[model samples]
Target: MSEHHELILTCPKGLESLLAEEAGGLGLEDVREHTAAIVGHAALEVAYRMCLWSRLANRVLLVIGRFPVTDAESLYAQVHAVDWREHLEVAGTLAVEFSGRGSGIDNTHFGALKVKDAIVDRLRDAGGLRPGIDKLNPDLRVHLRLDRGQAVLSLDLSGHSLHQRGYRLQQGVAPLKENLAAAILLRAGWPRIAAEGGALADPMCGVGTFLVEAGMMAADMAPNLRREHWGFSGWLGHVPALWNRLLAEAQERAAIGLARPPLWLRGYEADPRLVQPARNNIERAGLSSWVRVYQGELATFEPHPDRNQRGLVICNPPYGERLGDEASLLYLYQHLGERLRQVCLGWEAGVFTGAPELGKRMGLRSHKQYAFWNGALPCKLLLFKVDAGQFVTGERQPVARDTGQATPARLSEGGQMFANRLRKNLKQLSKWSVREGVGCYRLYDADMPEYALAIDIYQDWVHVQEYAAPRTIDPAKAQTRLLDALAAIPLALEVMPEKVVVKRRERQSGKRQYERQGSEGHFLEVREGGARLLVNLTDYLDTGLFLDHRPMRRRIQREASGKRFLNLFCYTATVTVHAALGGARQTTSVDLSKTYLDWARRNLALNGYSERQSLVQADVMEWLEKDSGEYDLIFIDPPTFSNSKRMEGVFDVQRDHVRLIDLAMARLAAGGTLYFSNNFRRFALDCRLLERYTAEEISAATIDEDFRRNERIHRTWRLQAGKTR
Candidate 1:
């Protein structure tokens, strides 16, 4: 067991060549690289050296035996042929792990059981107490790799994964694994930088993994010097004096490395909550004198290198992993790129991200990109030399900041509080939204009285309406709070800040609500209830679709199949789109404005509706009087009041609803349904309608969970031909 042993050093994929190079430098000969591991011939001391210093390895395995096997019996027989007494004591604990699935063993657990039974039986035959089972902290860990009718068994020389450098007992969300960090640093050429006395910094150093790793590399400290437990500590073939001599040399080298003046190493994390944890990690790594952690943001991240000094800027920015969160993360990547270009000029940079497309959005041309896997996620490491030529300072497209299911790195106190409320709403509504196939919905509606903002999510965009503050409240304070809410919208919703379109909403008496707010004229398509419609978030005060009317649109969709449908006061004709998609026989929509009628034309075309649908441009009250069309299904959602030039007089919902209902019901065929709704908070239903038509109050049912907080947003009723009495 002593002359020369076969060693397999396992690392993550993409690190095989690096592991082979490092293993060769550490007294290993005839090294051959494989997919995720490297095999070489080395003495037991060389294997011990790798376990102590090879930062990129997951496990340092000593190959004990290899044999041919085609079945469980052969596997057990081969494992039993090994002299277990040479490795594990009879009183010691052991665990077995089997990888690959072939040779009549489909389950890894079952294969491991067979191996364990063989080892136990052989140890028991040798007399003394048989080894007990220990999965965690086992004195010996046995691994078998099953390939095409062949089994290669080995003993794990590293107890826990070598990445568990004993420093990061706690970590930030999505922390980059430590060994991967070291490999990244190596690829970024940090070893040479350290040799030249160069510095290193990570702006988004979560739990200080990168900073601690750099500190150790710069100080020549073995990555596992402080690790107390090891797989070879209790192994029967262990040599104590040889191990101590190597350990003494590593200690002497570490002292000389640390005795020099420390490099200018710094880390800045945006999350204040992570600052202490990061500092604690640096302290645990015994490099607190050389490394420091600070609470700072990417916007203000400036590595305090001395004048005429340059260093590497490294970060692992968030790659959003939720539905709308990726759009928001673009800003984060752009922000990182901007900081690198603006401040760290003439320095090198490396950014690791799971989203390569977002990395491309950074507006920096990377000289090189390395692919790596974070668990099952494929990621890229973008390498940049932060020079003026590499920086693309062209006018950047406006990027917004939206958070994902995971919390964003930073938020203001007020923003955090408001974001918490928004997160609660999103968590509550996400399941229903996904189940109901809703891509757009009202996310917030002034749930907190101070922030009188109604927020809606249109896929990845956020639409915010700041309800005009009342005279009783301080206008300045109200505006400040509104700004806070607006700022919080993008962060909470995981949307780009520019994607948040905000407008002030007050009592619009006439066509003021329909007036254009901006000339951006750009439209975004949103999906709901199987229909897709265009919403002008910037141009119009209201997004082309009303979120509160979602349930009502769904109701029309379910009942409109094979029925003649009519929509009155159809501003953008969104309801007509739903009806047409729901299989309506024919649809007729009436509105006064030519602009809205043109918009209705586009809405009809968007849903592939042409011949069977008609759009009328006359004023609705005037058109209804002359129309002779009969509709089996009808819907009327009138504004609170209208003062348009097309109308003869000011039309108010409370004052003119009875006359309006009479006109709409005249167009309803026998045994037809007329759904009438209005947003007039103070309007009262007339007792006269109860006698003229059968009325069923559907105000409660039409309002969904999102609008339940403020049911006064609208009221509705289903009217037929008969009266209640």
Candidate 2:
């Protein structure tokens, strides 16, 4: 074993090159990459040093023996022959972890059991005492691997998986493991990007894992900067001085980075729930000031305000396996592609998804395609290059309906009739808003004129209003007329060529943010089922609160009483006042935007209940890390898109919803219920993802009177603690 004199380090697959570079940087010699290992010949201290400073590797393994084995008995015999006394005391506790591929040893558990028996038996026979098994915390950790009749035994220098970087005080759903995140950064050649001052962005960043990992990589900060302990620290051969020196050296290198925002780094998630956790992770990684997490819809992500072109945007959007259907995922991808081509010019893009078919929807040719494993699922990292100059930013062309024998002119005639009606309605709306003290007005004519499309933005209820037209008509003509009038409006508002969302007009088309503003504030009111609601007419194309969740708000008024309430991503605080009036003991509202959070406070005061509510102007995800307060009633309604100047970056609802839901459930009081809603029309809830909590679909209860044309406006859900797995 001593004569072999070579060190083989185990890293999460695909990070071998990074580990090799780290070893070389530490002055180790003969660095080479293997499938999941980095092999090099170095002094024993180099192995010890790697355990302290190498952030990309999972463990620094001190290889004890490598031999061929065909059976458990042979493996046991070989394991027994090792000098156990050198690594573990007779009375010490030891744990064995085994991984095998192909070969005769098919069961990893059985292999582990055999190795444990051999180690204990050999030690007992030699010293009259056997080491104890300590699975949770052990004095010695041994890793055994059998690959196609070849066996390797090594001491696990870093225990508990180096991915536990010790900085994660909290997390959201399917969080990228630290090691995995590091591998992703390494794969992206982050060091090279950072060196060039290239920007890093995660449009669907969850808990800021990717952003934090990228920041650490760019700054050359050790991945274990926050780690308090390592498995190697307990080894009999551990050198405390060397470990301390490595850590100090890494810290000194980080200090030289100046703590400046790398060329650029940002993350966006539509769900406000992830905004807080992502901020928490970034801060934990000492990247709070360097990385930003924004809570808003992807459609609203405008990287450049005046100039429409900008930097790279990367995302790890959810594959249907753990989230929802491929069809919905495809829509998200198509929408993302449309946005990317329109807004992000002269930029590069990378999308990691398990579903390859979905990648085709992006309509961009792959510059590079990499195979990666997100846990057990094989995923593809498809890279695309976008031309900022040639990007097309416009609404999607409507799909022709299979209306048999409908003449082309027949369709055009219907469209023209609808356009004329819309022109008339807009004229009336313009006159009414001017006369009725309104700024914007809703027009029944939009992408489809045969539909009841109400436009509003007249009054203060841009805070919460809806455009409700009492008549139902064909949607195609309405949509065309709506866009025509929008094009004709003399508003001086900035319209991002890439931010326009065009759809076939589903009965439930509330996915993207459709907001437009006129120099004048105008809104339209649609009365139906005895409810008259005003819609945002000027500041945005659509009103803020989807009017469909009106029932859920009413439910809050019906059920809230003497309970503490929490509203995450509290846009206009419509639900905050609802809970407060329902008699909540105290309400804490969270959102990234001070503008919206302040609006929520005003809404509460407007309803005569100000003393009972508190507004927190921070990312809810980050705030949850330091917040342990539980609430009896919680409302988590996040935006479809927002680019808050106060936040880190942008957000996408479909990508961040699962984790957001889980975290909200974590803070619920015993017997507490949380109302989580989203307007992403194509959103499909992953029941398996929320197996730890019981969820009931309250979509029916959330729909209000004015929003009956589309039933899926908002989804209300109740969660309780339970074992999902």
Candidate 3:
């Protein structure tokens, strides 16, 4: 049993090299790294020592036999060939775990059953009692892995994953496994820092995982010393005397390490709910004196250590899964950067995040980046050396009371890339805006697939709408790229963060487009086509004025000279105001909602034409059927879908567009034209309507230079009475 035998230490992916190094340090011979595992040769006592000490391994296995396996029968025969009596008693309870797939053993359950049956039949055939299966508490745990028609059967030395550590009883949301946390600390050079007795802090620590792990490492405590049971305890190969000697030595070393002065290890969590849980976990880990946690906000998270003390700042901050969520996470990362710059000078920062691009929002350049896997998702650890000499956007200068010179913040590489694109778009569109005297235009329309966002400029304020990403793309990745673009917005436009408004854009079925996104009734006035429009950029999903139809509004302005104008489905009546600007004699606008009719009233009042314009708050379809009104010029722009309670039936633009256009045409006078438009991406003009009316498709001319990239922004057509003009 004391003879050197092959042992394997399995770890999380990306930590194989680290595990091999640790195995060599643990006195294992011929240590080598493999895929998600480390292979070495060690005596039974050395394997026992590793089971009690190794921090970065999930499991430790002792190889017993390796034999050729072709099918379930061959797998059973090979497993039965092993000397079962030498490992466990014939009546002992056992569990079989199988991994990999090949040679007719397609699944783990079937493979495990074959191994179990083989062991049971072999023991019984030897004139001994049959062993029973005990998955939870087994006297022997057998692990089998099939690779290239070979089965490597082994006895599990560590029953459960070594990462259990038996310290963290309660955890916060998205908790990092104990082994992964140790690997992160090692990568961050925490052992060297701990030996020097430097302070450690986690600003966004949840349940104090890093603090507890760092505390144990600094105190020289064995990770699995407190584990009462192990896979070798019930095996015949276990040497109790050797294990006892190693345990005593570990206990003595822990006592010696704990006698020294405690290092400053502190954690701050933004959630008040997690503060108590973090404290409990710290106390359970016997680190109450060395580690502590407090309820704190990221913006005000300040860790005060002793003088002349510099340490590592490590944290795994909260992340999001949706594109619009970047608005807040972007600021979260920025706040961390601000804190690092303001207070953590001469310190090292290790930021672990699943959304790697969000790491760019911190503005601090990382000297080194290490890739690690957090389960199935890949994450990055950005190592930054906080110093005065490493700023690109410069430091925050003091603001004067009169001048109001706000602090200038730096953009990260990704943020800078997006900012440059925004600047390029603005530079090209500025000439068009100056020539047309247009105050609102689309600055960007998802020019970069990485940054799937539409950025619009309302004179000085910026309006950004995020289109939901596809289902196939990872939400975490989409959100990180989104953070990059959002972090660049204010920097690119040289505007305040408050001036940038963000909203999500999707297919609106009913009155959802007009639904209030916020209660703040703030309004901003922007100009278009020589007309001043009132836009509530903060109060709704839409900013009241549709910038994509800028040229179409101008077309209406030029075509409505001395003609009676009628606007159907008139949302906010911005086009009606343009019609009134073109010397229209009288104009009537119809809508279903009283809120919009009131808004239309305010729009007309803003233009000083209350008498000539009329705002009716009736359902356009129902009202058009009842009215006997005729106009020289008319416009119809309907919603893609509407199921409002007041409306008699649901309205779908694709299904009921033909009926809608014919009703609006009834109100058009002879020789007058009806201009129709809708923003549906898949909108197709009805051939039935085309057969009845002389229609001229003008979709291309309606879209201006700013919206030319997204030709599907909206469709427009000019229609007149009769099949032949």
Best by lDDT: 3
lDDT of each: 0.85, 0.65, 0.86
Query: By TM-score, is 1 or 2 better?
Result: 1
Once fitted onto the true fold, the runs of candidate 3 whose alpha carbons sit more than 4 angstroms away are 125-129, 305-307, 393-408, 411-453, 456-463, 466-485, 491-676, 680-712, 716-725
The weakest ten consecutive residues by lDDT in model 1 span 400-409
TM-score of each: 0.62, 0.52, 0.72
What is the C-alpha lDDT profile of model 3 across 1-725, one tens digit per residue?
44999999999999998888888888899988888998999888789989999999999999998898888999999898888989988889999999999998899999999999999988884555698889987999999999989889999999988999887888898999999999899999999988877889999899989998899999998888788889998998888899999999999988887788998888999789999999998887777878989887766666665536888999997766542355656667776787787778788889999877767767688889999998998999899888867644467334334733335365557778999999999899999889989888898998988788889888888888988898888987876677667878877888866577777887666889887777677778777777878998767778889888888889999999999999998999999999999999999999998888888888888888899798898888899899998899999988888878788888989999998898888888999999999988888998888789999989999989898789889999999999844
Candidates 1 and 3 compared by lDDT, better number: 3
Backbone clashes in model 1: 8
Winner on TM-score between 1 and 3 is 3
Badly placed stretches (over 4 Å) of model 1 are 125-128, 394-673, 676-725
Q: How displaced is residue 347 in candidate 3, in Å?
A: 1.4
**What residue pairs clash in candidate 3, if any at all?**
none
Highest TM-score: which candidate?
3
